[model samples]
Target: MKTRTSKTIGVAASAAAIALSVPLAVTAYAQPSDSDAPAAEIPDPQGPECGAFKEALPNWKGLADLPVSAALASIPEISTFNSAISGGMNPAVNITSVLDNGPYVVFAPTNEAFAELPPEQAAYLRTDAAGLTNLVYYHAFLGLLGPDDVKGQRPTQEGTEVEVTGKGGDIQVNATAKVTCGGIQAQNARIYIVDQVLDPAEAPAPITPTSTSATTSVTPTTTAPATTTAAPTATTEPAPAEAGAAEAPAG
Candidate 1:
C-alpha cells in the first residue's frame, strides 16, 4: 500500500496541506499524562482467564473463521470503515486486498467516531478514496497484534508508523484513540474497534484548579492549567495561542 501514494487531489490535497499550514494548538491527542503511567494503572478488560496471545479466546459469533473482508463487513459498528475500504480510488488501488492479507491489525473506527470527523469531508473521502485510503493504511498494522503485543511503534501499509501504547484493556493507538473493543480475530486479521479515529495529525494538543507558578522549561505536571497551556519557557512567550495538535476537528 505504501507504493500507492497519496494523491493531492480534492479533499486529499486539503488533508495533506494542513500538515504544513500554521501549527495550531491541539491537545486532544497528546499523551494524556506528562509521562507514561505505570503498566498497572491501565486496566485490562478481560478477566484473568484471558491473555492477549492465547488462542483466539472467544470472539463475536465465529468471526475468527471468516475471511478478513467478510468478517469486517459483517460487523455493523464499523460499517463506515468497511465501506470505504471496500471501494478504491479506482480498480488499480485495491485497499480491500491489502486488508484481506493478514495477519493484519485493522483499527476500525466506529460510526460515531466517523461522525466526529467533518461530515462532508468524511463522506467525501469515502468516495474520493484518497484521504481515507491513506488514513486506512495508516491505521493498519500488517501483522497480528494481540493485547500484549500491541505496544510499541508498529509498521503500517502507509509510510508513517503508529505508536500504540497502554496495557491490556486500556490500550490506545498513538496513545489517544481508545480501543473500545479489541482482540476480534478473523482468518487473516485481528480487528480492533476504536472510539476515535487516530488521524495523521497530532491531536489538536486540558484543565485544572489554580496555576500561577512560572517555570523556565516546558514541564508537564501531573496536574496542569489546560492541555494547551504549558509553563512559559525562557525563550518564548506563553499565550493561549494555537500550537499543532491531533486529529479531532477544531472549532
Candidate 2:
C-alpha cells in the first residue's frame, strides 16, 4: 500500500512539471523576434521656406498633372508670382499661356520679395507691360532643373542668362538671390522659390570710365607783376639835354 502511494505521488509530480513546461514553451513560441517586427517610418526634412507649406499640404506628392502656372498659383506663398502671370500686366508676352505648355524650370519670388523691392521698381513693373514681361521671362528656363542640376549660367525665355551656383544646401541665382525652396515638381516643370526678384536688365553694368575722362591735367597760370610808372619829372628831361650839351662842350 505504501509503494502504491509513492507511485501515485511520483505520477502527480510528473504531470505538474509537464503542465508548467507546456505553458513556457507556448509563451516562447508566441513572442515576436526583433527581425519580424515592422520598421518605423521616418519623414524627409523640408527646406526652410517649404516647411510650413509641407505641413499645410501633408498629402501633396507632386502637382504632376497640373500645368506649371497652375501649380504655382496653388501655393499661397507665391501668390505674387501667380498674379503677375495671370493679371494681364504684359499683353505682349502671355506668361500664363507660356507656362501652361512648358517643360521649364521656374524660379518664383514670393510676395514678400516683391514687397521688399524698391517701391519704384515694383510700381514700374506693375504698369510697364513689356518690362514686366521680360522680368517674368527672366525667371524661367527651357527645361526642368532640380537643385542638383542647377549650376553655371542657364538661358531664360527673355534671352538673358541667370548665373546659378550651389553650395551645401543653399542655391543662389544671379549671384544675389538665394533659392529658399526648391525641387517642387509640376506636370511640365520644376519650381524653385527664391528670396529676391531676379532682374537681368536691372543688373548694374560694370563701371568703366569713358576715354574722354583720362587723367586730368591742371595748368597753372602765371600772374605778371604790376608796373609802376613814376611821376614824370620835368627835371629829368632837362637833365638829359643839359648832360648832352655839357659833354659836347667838354669834348
Candidate 3:
C-alpha cells in the first residue's frame, strides 16, 4: 500500500510539471523574435539634379521681396527659360521689363521640359526671334492668378486665350500642358512651374478668318453691280436690232 501511494504522488507531480512546462513552451513560441520583427522602411534618396535645384532656390523670407524675373533667375530648374529671356534669344521682347513692370502670372517651364522638345522645333526656337517671342508671351498672363484663379479660359500676353481646366486636383492648360508647382508669389508677379512649354502657334485665332470672310463678301458685292449694268446694255442693243429688222421688213 505504501509503495502504491508513493507511485501515485510521483505520477501527479509529473503531470503537474508537464502542464506548467506546456504553457511556458507555448508562451515562448508565441512571442516574436528579433528576426521576425518588421523591417524599417528605407527613404528614397534625392537625385543630384534635384538636390542642386533645391539649393538654388531663394530662402523663404527673401523670395517675397524679389521680382518675378529675379525669382526665376534664382532657380536652377528654370535656368533654361531665364537664359532664353535674358540672353537675347528673342530681340523684340523685353522680358526683364515685362516682369519688372507688373502683376503677371508666368507659367515657367522646367529645363527638362525644354529638353523634351522635338529637336527640329527646339533648334528653330533657339534662333527664330518671332517664334521665341511668341512662345514666351504665350506663357505669360496679364494679371496675377493663383491656383483658384487658374481655372477657365485666360488671355495671354501673346494676344490669344488658353483653356485652363482643373480635374481631380490636377490643373491643365490647353488640355496638354500641366501645372506642376503653382501659386509661387514674387513681388511683381506669380510664377507657376509647368511641365511643358506653351506654344502660341497652337492657340486658335478666330478673328483673322472672320475678318477675311467680311472682306470676301464685300468684293463679290462690288463686282455684282458691274455685271448687272453690262447685262442691261446687252438687252438694250438687242431690242434696237429687232426694231431695225421690223423697219427693213416694212421697206
Candidate 4:
C-alpha cells in the first residue's frame, strides 16, 4: 500500500504553533454492501480524529460533540460530499439525520472524488434518494473505527465486505483507494476522507492475511520428505523502504 496524504483541510498547517492546552495525536475501513460493525468504545475527548488543528473549531466543544452531518459541513474540500448528503434528492429521506445518529465510520469522498464518477452515474446517484442513500451507506461502516482500529476484511452494511490493509497511517480500502485525510470525527462516528468512491460491486476480492502456519512449518521435527527440500524465503521479508511508513511522522 502507499502512504496516506492528509487531504483534510488544514492538515498541513502549523498545528504546533496553535498551542492548544490539550495535545492530540493523529491516526488512521469500508464496504459496498452497507457496513455494520459494532460501535467501538474509543473515548471521544481525544481521538485520532484530532489529526490537525482547526482554529475555527469551537473552544468548548470537540468534534465528538457534533453529529456527522455537521462535521461534513465543516470541511471545505469535501463540500461536494456535504452537498450530496444534504441533497440526497428525496425530501422524504434524511441522509443528514441518519449520519447525525451514527456511530458509523464514513469513508467520505472529496469533491474531486465525486467528479471522477461517470457523468451518468453521478447524475443518477444525486437524483435518486434510494440510490444515493445506498451509495452513502455502502461507504460507511457501522460503529466507530479509526485508522488504528481498521484491519483485514470487514463486512459492510450495503450487502458485502470490504478489504482493509495497512497499519498506522498507510491504510488502503479494497487495496487501492487511499485515505487522503483520516480520522475526522462526529459525535457518533469517524471519517476517513478517501480519494476514490468505493463500490461493493467493483471491489476486489477480500485479502487473506498471511497465515502464521507458513512461517512455522519449519518447526515440525518429523523428517518428512518435504522438509528435505530447501526453500528460499528471500522474498517474504519487508523491503527496506517500507520499514516505517506512517501517516507522515508528526511533523
Candidate 5:
C-alpha cells in the first residue's frame, strides 16, 4: 500500500512540473532577441521619381485643371504619360512621340482633353506625325513657366504668342482657358492645372484660282457698264452747257 501511494505522488508531481515548464518554454521562445526576428518592410508610396512632392503636397490639385504640358515634358515614357493623365486626358491613343526640350511650346492635351477634340483633329494627331510634332512645339515657351509665373502674356516657342489672365479667382492663360489650381514645384519643373485643353492652330484654307472664262466674263461685264454710261453723259452735258450760254447772251 505504501509503495503504491509513493508511486502515485511521484506521478502527480512530475505532471505538475511538466505543465509549468511548457508555459516557461513558450514565453522564452516568444521573447527572443530582436536580431533573431525578421525585419519589418516599409512600402514605397511615390512613383518612380523618388521625390517627396506627393507626400509633401497631398492637397495639391495636380494636373486636374492644367493642360498636359508639364507631365508630357517631365516624364518621357508614354506609359507613364498614359497613367498620369488617365482621368479625362486620352493622348495615350493618339500620341506616339513626345518632345520636351525642342524649341516649341506644347500644351499637350490629356487623354481626356484629346478625346474632347473633334474627330478630325484627333485623327490628324494620330496619323500625322510631322503635323503633331509641329503642333506640340507651337504651344511651348522658352522659359519654364508655373501657374504664378504665367500671368498676362507669354511668347510661345513659335513666333506667335499666347495671353494669360486671371479670372474668377483662377488664373486664365491664353485661349480664354482657366487654370483652377496649381503651383507644384518639382525638380527643375513646375506644373499648372488648367481648366481646358489647348488646341493646335488651324491651317488656312487654300485659295482656288477662278476659271479663265469666268474671269474674262466678269472683267468685260464690270468695265462695259462704267464705260458706256460715262462717255454718253459727258458729251450730252457739254452741248447743253453751250446752248444755255448762247440763250443767256441773246436775252
Candidate 6:
C-alpha cells in the first residue's frame, strides 16, 4: 500500500513540471530581439525649385511629415547655416528655432539683405552673437500664415508692427518693399523669398517721455501786466477844482 501511494505522487509531480515547461518554451519562441524591432518614422522635406539655390541644400525627402526643426536640419543648407552667420544673416537658424511651436509665415530675405546693410553693421552681425540672433529673430513670425493669409497688420519678430499689402490678386509680405518669391511650405514654417532684404533698424523708435527736471526748465516765464490808458483819469472836470479853490472867496 505504501509503495503504490508513493508512485502515484511522483507521476502527478512529473505531469505538472511538463506542463510548466511547455508554456515556458512557447513564451521564449514568441519573444523578439530589440535589434529586430521596427524602425522609427522620419519626415520628408519638399519645396519649390529655384535654380542652383534649391539644389545646393540637401533634399529633405520626408520633411512635410516631420517636426519643423527636424525638417530644417535635414536640409543641406542647414549644415551651412553657421557659415551663413556672416553679415548677421542667420535667418535659417532663427526660423528653425521658432518653428517648433509655429506655423510661421516668414518673409525670408535673400542673402542680399545682409549684404545690403552697411559694412560695419554686417560685420557686427556676423561676429556679434547677440546681434546676429536678434537680427534673425526680427524676421520670423509666430503664425503659420501663407501667402494668402497675409492681411491687415502683423508685428515683426522684433516686435515692430508692419502693414501687409498684396499685388495682382496675390498676397505679399511687405514692410516697405515687396517680397519676391511667394511661398515655400515647411512642416510648420511657410517660408517666402524676398528680393529686398529687411532692415530692423529702419523701424521708427517709440517716443520717450521728457524728464520732470527738463519740463521744469522749459516752463514759460510770467509776462508783464498790461496797462490801459486810465480813460482820461476822469476825463474833464478837474476844471472846477481851481474855481472851488476857496470857500473863503464865496464868503
Most accurate candidate by TM-score: 2
Tell me which of candidates 3 and 6 scores higher on lDDT.
3
Give one digit per residue, the lDDT tens place, for model 3 in 69-120: 8887877788888877775555554577777787887878889999999999
TM-score of each candidate? 0.54, 0.59, 0.57, 0.56, 0.39, 0.47
Q: What TM value does model 3 have?
A: 0.57
Candidate 2 residue-wise lDDT, 121-158, digit = tens = 87888888888888898889777766776665656778
Off by over 4 Å in 5: 1-108, 167-169, 200-251
Give one digit per residue, the lDDT tens place, for model 1 in 38-66.
53322233313234323333345467778
Kindly list the per-residue Cα lDDT of model 5 for residues 1-251, writing each as its tens digit. Answer: 99999999999999999888785544344677889889543222222222433444453344333334444443322222333233222344333233333322234333445456688876675666565545544445544455444554444544345565653235655545554433443323344444355543532222223555332112121224444444544334343455446454564
The lDDT of each candidate is 0.66, 0.73, 0.69, 0.66, 0.43, 0.53
Clashes (backbone N, CA, C under 3 Å), per candidate, total: 19, 0, 0, 12, 18, 12
lDDT tens readout by residue for model 4, 1-251? 12344443345455645766456765523464434666555342222333442433444235566788887787776777777778644454457877776778787787788889999998787677777777777777676776777655665657466676775567778888887656666778887777788877775554343555432112223344664657866667665766566666686
Error of 6 at 98 (Å): 3.2
Worst 10 residues of 6 by lDDT: 42-51
In angstroms, give how far residue 18 of model 1 lies from its true place.
94
**TM-score, model 2 to reference:** 0.59
Name the regions of candidate 3 deviating beyond 4 angstroms: 1-58, 88-93, 167-169, 204-251
For candidate 5, what is the TM-score? 0.39
Model 6 residue 8 CA deviation (Å) reads 44
Off by over 4 Å in 4: 1-61, 88-93, 204-251
Stretches > 4 Å off in candidate 2? 1-46, 88-93, 202-251
* Residue 167 C-alpha lDDT in model 3: 33
**Deviation from native of the Cα of residue 140 in model 1, angstroms:** 0.7
Residue 169 miss distance in model 4 (angstroms): 1.7
Candidate 5, run of 10 with poorest lDDT: 214-223
Model 6 alpha-carbon drift over 4 Å, by segment = 1-63, 69-95, 167-172, 204-251
